[model samples]
Target: MRYSWLALICIAQLSFAQKKQITLEDIWVKNTFRPKVVPGFNAMSDGKVYTQIDKEGDRQVLRVYDLKTGKQERTVFDNGEHTLEGKQLSLDDYSFSKDEKKILIRNEGQPVYRRSALYRSYVYDMSTGKVLQIDTAKVLHATFSPDGSKVAFVSANNLYYKDLKTGETVAVTTDGVVNKVINGNCDWVYEEEFEFTRAFDWSPDSRYLAFYRFDESQVPQYILPMYTGLYPYNYVYKYPKAGEPNSVVQIKVYDVKDARTVTANVGTETDQYIPRIKWTKDASKLCIFRLNRLQNNLDLLLADATSGNSSVIYNEQNPYYIDIDDNLAFLPDNRSLVLHSERSGYNHLYRWDWKSKRLTALTGGNYDVEQIVGIDEKRNLVFYTAAEKTPVERKLYSVNFEGKNRRTLTPEEGTHGITPIEGFNYFLDRHSTLTMPSVYTLRDNKGKVVRTLEDNAALKGKMWEYDLGNISLRQLEVGDNKTLNAWVITPPNFNDQKKYPVLMFQYSGPGSQEVGDRFPVRDFFWHQMLAEKGYIIVCADGTGTGFRGQEFKKKTYLQLGKYESDDQIAVATYLGTLPYVDKSRIGIWGWSYGGFMSSTCLFKGNDVFKMAIAVAPVSNWRYYDNIYTERYMRTPQENEKGYDENAPEKMADRLKGKFLLVHGTADDNVHFQNAVMLTDALIKANKEFDGEYYPNRHHGITGGNARFHLYKKMTDFVLTNL
Candidate 1:
């Protein structure tokens, strides 16, 4: 009997060992059975969140999650209605009513430009459980009024309103025609530069409709092509590159009660840009932010909705150019606005009091305040995340509005985020490091971490199973003895005796730092894969990269990629001293601005870098956007050296490596022309290189197996080409 029992135990142990050797397909299939994380999040007053998530294999859902737990509560809208009655839909976005019952679900969205899209939106009423269609699926920028009774949407390039109760649709603007007078939503230039999508806003009383009426009639038309191939056939937006004339923009307020439209008497000669309009806390006042084509001067105007009178309350100017208030927030009292400014050399927060017309520095330091998430005025506490203490690290802090009592929270280190309590009593802290996944904890207002909700123990164990490298953060002494922060990830199976190839990744844009103290993202996964196959991944935050100070970051003024190449060459110089590094096999790669840097490295630093892969790079500053290029580099004429001195097009003949230029044909951000022109220059200069053209793909070349296939190709190329 003892022998028989022992035999059974041995068989059970063998079975467990067999199960441990699972394949990637098995893991993927098993992961599909679990709940998926949805992208596109919008928080609601009822402590609920809506997102675009997949439900089964083919269908998608605009689901409502509990936020506290990951449990999904209800399916607000589903899209598989062709054959099945109760099927889930893949909603692009969902907007909630004031009461949190009625939801405007956006679907079948077609892109107009970088920041604008026309969609088939539906109105879902929670009480009746009935989904109603608005604008009959031919609308964009559908927004509900403050009362949530009336829905204002853009259709046929015109503003329209729909009454929920009466089911009546009214055309709000008659002069709205394509390429002439655009109402409700913004034009291509305004949308791309100002980042304005829903141009129209409702008054507090929902009686007035305030919007910008863009006159793009004088703007020249730019066109790209569309082709019918394997996937869906389509045409992309006609985008105007840099040095192009932007649209003439102005503001207008429409009175719903009297049916009177008043174009704000800001006067013509407004050849600049009116990017935003918001109804002030006071029902009578409407606020607008306007900037010139150079984007140097910015004005915050308070316009009287009833009288159509306007007054510039505050203005911000810089020698180079001013940046938009990306994380702008209005105080609860409605008397002041919170703004982010780089005027102090570092990005900080300032309070703009409307009544007094005074500016007060709310948060200031050498580090950048990443974003002001929440504020507790009563407690004199302002909760924000910043790169203080260390640029590579992020932490949450609650300081006084007067900028005192700055205490650090989430002392566990790495990238930290906090969700403060309703009354600023308790807070939820989520933190992670390079080797750790996200760990969530409950903390008090005093920064003491209490109950631990999730530690990501499962994910951490899985990551541990896959051998990782020693990811070290250090500072580099680059050109002219400038200290630069950098990170290096040594291959998992690194050996000092063996020479390993290196891949340098970076996005050397102003105020943009790549060397962050965050957990390994998708890039890390690929980096680990390459490291295991004998390659070192290094990221150097060169000059023009933000966070050190204004002087260090703005050194690339009037130029974008020149200083970056010099500093990256310095990185290669440093790496050559290391015994384990193969200096001849060092390569560089990036997307967009990073791509531009990678191209410059291969051409200018041909002796240092042996290979480069630039995906969707801007070959020239003159071919980029106005707001981005004009900010640091200024106009091409004002500073020709900044624009033409070291252009990738001009340095094409200097290429000494096996360069691979990849670009999506439909990428409006960095046009395919960049690739074509670079390719033409290389060919004319008698240089040998390779390229891959993805037709109908956007800036992010993602689709059914497209991303996976492309990455696989990149892996194979890097392994062989380098």
Candidate 2:
């Protein structure tokens, strides 16, 4: 009888070991674990329902759903029924006007850069069901005016406005030549770094249009070769590198009634950047964000549109650098504005009064406020997400305008993302944990769950079929004596007695967090595939990562890759001491900034890492863009040692590991020149390394079978080397 029981237990163990394992094809090729997502949900003006984009046949439709019952209320627009220019209209995206009387439709959007796209725009009136194209030419950042009487757009690098009723088009600016002047849209650097494509704003009363004009003729151009034709074509555009001359920017306000333009009294610093501009509740005042070239000083300016005069309402200064965020919200009272500041060594919400010229703290804590969800002026409550509960998780909280009555809204122990309705009476909570798929739920303003919109049960059921790994979240103390967050994934059949090879991944960019409790859909599957192959996958959020506070994030400020690499090396050193870790076979890998880190780690941490993979890495700070590189390293000219000491191009001779460098030739973000330069350095150093390039692929390196091929190659490299 004892032998029979032992045999049954052994058979159970064998069955568990033979469970279906995750495969690379299941992750990349078959896409067996992709989760269903709720895309493009916008709250309606009525505050009871939301509109979502849906597909029917080959056409797109705008369907509205009741927020309470999660049922389709009606379809607002269907591309199958709409015709433009005697052709079936293709709806790329749509936005409603302020009063919801009209819709701005975008079609045939061609992306120019990271955040800038040229689209053919049309205005559809709900009352008359009539559609009119805004312009014959493709335009960028087209939108209906606040009053819905006109539409403004940027075409041919120039700003134009069309009077909907009169059908008269007026050019706001005309000196908009290619590679010289840009009127209403941001340049590549501003679009990529400042995170804005539209460089124009409509005033509250729709009387004035505030826009930025850029003169890029003096800025040097970077040429990228496109391999689409027999003879490769060169695509050239103005791109300023580190320590290079930037476009001279000007802020101007156009008075609609007077048909005149007035230049705002921004300082005469041509190198400075005007990052943001928005109209205040009082139409007379326009809020402008001005930052110096060093990005250490940020000024919040209130400009008088009529007089073209401006005054500094608030001055923010940081010793290292000031960060830009979407946190400037004007109150309905027209006398105060809510601003995000790190004055207390953490990002918090503060109210700035125009009359008193004083700043009052509205939210105060050691933790950083992640975002401002909504402001309920009538209730004197400000809803926001903060890292009060845990750094890896975000929780919704509401506090009074005076920093009282702080209450946590989310009870679940994971990352909670909230999309509040018009009046903050209801919100859509998309919650997820490390092991759980995203669950979308509609909740009241007070945090009661109304209904579940999407539970991703299909993907959840498929996840059980695979013998996925077990994730363990831990904190390890690094060389700086600070605890860093890390996540380790072990195989389902993990044995404590056996030492497993480890693969470490990190993207240690400034103010970026990767080690969160949120589920990683595709990447998680890839990690599980690796785990099934008898390897451990680990991700550590090192120094300079966000959600901790200002000090921890800014530790590697001037020296971009120095502290970040050190923390990774320190974490690896600690992990090496573990009993189940095979220290001699450890590897490190990353992409973009992560790629940059991986290269630096393999070079500087050569004593620890045995293999490394870097994809689309910035070889040197000088080769990167002006805005991002300068903000962190203050240009190669200003801090030559900061740029030279940590750059992987300079450390090519220190490569002591099995290195694989992969890059996309058409990666405009981190240009292919970076790879060429580093390859030259490696050749000069007589270093042996493996390299691969995807022709005509962008930074993401995705299209058709590109991603699957790349991951397959990477998997083989890991299996052979690590």
Candidate 3:
């Protein structure tokens, strides 16, 4: 019996020796854990077909496939087969016209901002098989007309359109300049905060073009230094900080036939914001969303495209602030609209009748609806995804227009993301859990699986060869009858009696969540490597996070970082009581808003955390932009104490932990001035800390070896300090 037991132990030891250990090179440089995704998957106008971009030889080929059979039907365009000006065409992206008779192909795209880009555009005729370049120079937001007769685009802050037959380009605005007047394109602040790039829309009937004109001559300029060559050059652009002057915006309608422009009446206040301008089914009517400076009130206006006259159709007011999203959709009847609102303390869909001015609920519950999938007008069904199961998981559900017969379409646990086809007959669902990789599948409108797409099978198989740990979700009760959602990742061979150092991660921003059930694509493998080093990783979604309720998300209002830091401290206090945790060796780290949270936690919870690392943090709210900063917190002029009391720079004297501050010098989003201000305060307080700066890097700090080097530096810091 003893000999048999020794043989079994020898076999177990041999099996354990075959398991592989994860390295930083495999996670960052080798691309070992990357998952396969459907590239450029776009649904066709027909509900039965879809188009995807694939590589044939060295060129890209756009091919159409049958949804039901999962077979290739035809090839629409092949860059190797087509030529423009004696050169083979290259395709980055393509969009179909309303009739699908023509396509607008984009190539050689150059990014201008976070959401905006300039591209060399061309038009391809399906009948003639001819390719014509729209312009010799690159253009922005090039769009096709409904009738496929013309194309509109923005160039050098001006709006222009070209007639396909005559090939004549006409300018709609003549006063466009480089840094002053912008036409048919969003300004920097609007593109970043409002989350939109093209600030223009075409009428459904192709009669009028509605666009925005921004006069930013009065706004202040921020200069970013480029450290290259012998002499450094400064790139200057208008940036409106908190309590600074904003651009004067105006909405204009252009008549293509008459070549005239009329400004819409958006009130006399130039400080307000026009977040969105959409065209209704009625070509003569345009819908606009107007928000106040404080963002507490939102008004929906319907404007006449010809006369530029407008009237308020709907209005909503919130005590804290309102969030703008692309959730408003008008029905084909043109008399009703569907949108999401938080009036009931949770985000839910509501249908509003334009003529009758009556509102009715379409979906209601304690859970918040994440997004509106599609509206099946023929079947009178509205499909959406919500947190009905739990705050950390998202499931797909469908309900009638009258808020009856609610059915759960995705019954399995985890997060399910849906993308519906044109006619609402089919959808593409990409689902994943905390432990499982993503699985992409095609489904019918009734939630019947049609076919399996990419399932990340190769990546899943590769993960089994490595020594990974278990990630579990739990609720940590922090005080006041409140509990925070948290996830803990323990070491591979965890023991109940051995003590391990803990590293806490969180973003802790308002309406943000770090403790979700979805697969952690960003830093999952890195956390696993840390776990292999005998450390426990914990992430908690604190009081200011989203999906719980409006009240919970807004609890940090007027005091941005107070409650969030307090909750982290409370969580640390609770984790200290665990038998496996070493209370004296706890550390925290985050990036961007998370970086701000980490800095705040290190200073405010000086007795709890022993070390911290902050990357690209916002040290002061006054250094940020106006639209995002003033939403949660009023202007610094109005709320002086609110902006100063919780600032990390103001609390520099309280730092007792091993601190590491990192930032990219050319980050346009959160300027490097934030780091400079915080460093000044730390130096004046006689505090010793470590710092690193990447020259000419943007907010993401990723290009070539930059990201890998960053992780290496951070890994060494954590190992040495924590």
How does each model score on TM-score? 0.87, 0.96, 0.98
Residue 635, model 2: lDDT of 77
- Please list all clashing residue pairs in model 1, or write none if there are none: 60-89, 78-88, 78-89, 79-88, 79-89, 558-642
Off by over 4 Å in 2: 1-18
Model 3 agreement with the true structure over 1-722: per-residue lDDT tens digits: 99999999999888777878898899889999999987788888989988888887889888899988879999989888888978877888899988888889998999888998899999998888999899999999999988899999999999999898889998989899978999999999999999998988889888799999999999999999999999999999999999998999999999988888899989888899999998987889999899999999999999998899999989999999999988888877888888999999999999999799889898877889998988888887889999987899998888887788988888889999999889988889999999889899998877888988889999999998898888999999876777899999999989989999999988888898888898863488998889989889999999889999899999899899999999988888889999989999899999999898899999999999999999999999999999999999989999999899999999999999999999999999999999999999999999999999999998999888888999898899999998
Q: Candidates 2 and 3: which is better by TM-score?
A: 3
- How well does candidate 2 score on lDDT at residue 483? 91
TM-score preference between candidates 1 and 2, better one: 2
Per-residue alpha-carbon lDDT of model 2 for 322-368, expressed as tens digits? 88878778888878888888889999999888778878898877889
Model 1 agreement with the true structure over 361-465: per-residue lDDT tens digits = 877778878888677767866788888888888888877766677788766568886665555656666777766667776676777876665776776666545
Total clashes for model 1: 6
Window of ten residues with lowest summed lDDT in model 2: 519-528
Residue 223, model 2: Cα distance from true site in angstroms: 0.5
What's the lDDT for residue 359 in model 3?
Answer: 91
lDDT of each: 0.76, 0.89, 0.91
lDDT ranking from best candidate downward: 3, 2, 1
| TM-score of model 2 (CA atoms) | 0.96
Least well predicted 10-residue stretch by lDDT in candidate 1: 29-38
Which model scores highest in TM-score? 3
